[model samples]
Target: MPTPSEFFDPSFIAILKLFLAMLLGGIIGTERAVFARQAAGTRTFGLVAMGACLFIVTGNYVDVAYLGVLSFDPLRVAAAIIMGIGFLGGGLIIFRGDSLHGVTTAAGLWIVAGIGMAVGFGLYLIAIFATFLTLLMFTGMWFVEDRFKHWFEEVKGDSR
Candidate 1:
């Protein structure tokens, strides 16, 4: 067997970690693509996740330096990313004569960013697990909401 150093170099480990983050982030994004189509689809979600991951990685690297120098906040980048993403989301939103749409797309963008942050921290299991849970919620939530709405309406009809 190789030595510990050979098996684990800091550079290799960091790179591998970053790659895994991108992979998992992409997976989370695919879930969003289902509802974000025609607005912020698969490619947009993937980009958002990767961008957030990079911002979080930078935040980790410059946190101490910025803190020590009193030059800037390391979280500034992340804050800016979040704000800019909000603007993008707003653009995606629509209110056509009181008919609302695109909120799901906007929310997906936000969630993709969170997944990226998890990946940036090299929390592979959490990131992957979160992706599964998010997907499940995205699908099951709609069904649950619809079913409840139908059931409530049926009961109300009987009462009437």
Candidate 2:
């Protein structure tokens, strides 16, 4: 068995962060798949989160200082990730007739990217809490919205 220090090694920690990001994203994706029945389900969300985390982790380890390069802003990579996610999210959205669809799924993806970024930056608590809140919004808000729609339908029926 490896020593305890091995677990705390930077490389090990980085891998751990990636797995955590994937797991968290998978949790959100599970809800979308099983409950919402979205096309972009567990694999899609997990891959997105893992990809974002990979970019962040790679940026962190680029070693520009050793290459005698100055003014390397890591946030640039983050901004690029955001822009990329925006493109992907945009693709998910569809406008048909008088209504739009996939907005929630796109938003879920956007937030999952943020969650991965957070995990990649070593903010475990924030990432986990954000994941919790995302799930809550997904499942809980769905329940609330369903109830509200039912109630509205009932009121409309009464009026008719």
Candidate 3:
């Protein structure tokens, strides 16, 4: 049997962080899938979050292990992750004349990456709160946006 301390080991904590990241990402992705009908849903968001968390955790481990031997900036890994996510987000966006699609989905992916990084850094409360806020934005803001659109259309029609 493993000792209680073993459960609190760094490796175990890292795994926990990854799991939390995935769970949070999946929650956002589920909202997108069910409501937004986006193609990149739970699996995509979960993988993005998990991959980001893995990069951060591994970077931290490398930094600590090479403390005196080599100079390593873990923040560089985070910057790289953000840049990569930006590239991915760009791919999600499509512009056609007067309309743009997938902007919100791209933004969601970006925020999801940040959430993963926060979880990797053990900012559990912040990550959870961010996830909640994200859900609110996705669902609540959608309703507000739709209402505004309808109201604007009605006013426009009356003016015409």
What's the lDDT for all of these models? 0.72, 0.90, 0.93
Write out the backbone clash pairs for model 1: none
Q: Which stretches of candidate 1 lie over 4 Å from their true place?
A: 1-14, 34-38, 63-73
Candidate 3 error regions (>4 Å)? 1-7
Ranking by lDDT: 3, 2, 1
Task: Give a tens-digit lDDT track for model 1, residues 1-160.
Answer: 7743377864565566566656765665666665534556667777777777777776766765577675766467767878878888889889999799888778767777777777776766887788787777777887998899999999999998
What TM-score number comes out for model 1?
Answer: 0.75
Whole-model lDDT for model 2 versus the true structure?
0.90
Better of 1 and 3 by TM-score: 3
- TM per model? 0.75, 0.88, 0.93
Error of 1 at 82 (Å): 2.2
Model 3: pairs clashing at backbone N, Cα or C within 3 Å:
none
Clash count, one per candidate: 0, 0, 0
- Among all windows of 10 consecutive residues in model 3, the one with the lowest summed lDDT is 3-12
Over 29-132, each residue of candidate 2 has an lDDT whose tens digit, in order, gives 99999999999999999988988898888888785434557556778989999999999999999999999999999999999999999988888899999999
Model 3 agreement with the true structure over 63-113: per-residue lDDT tens digits:
999999999988899999999999999999998999999999999999999
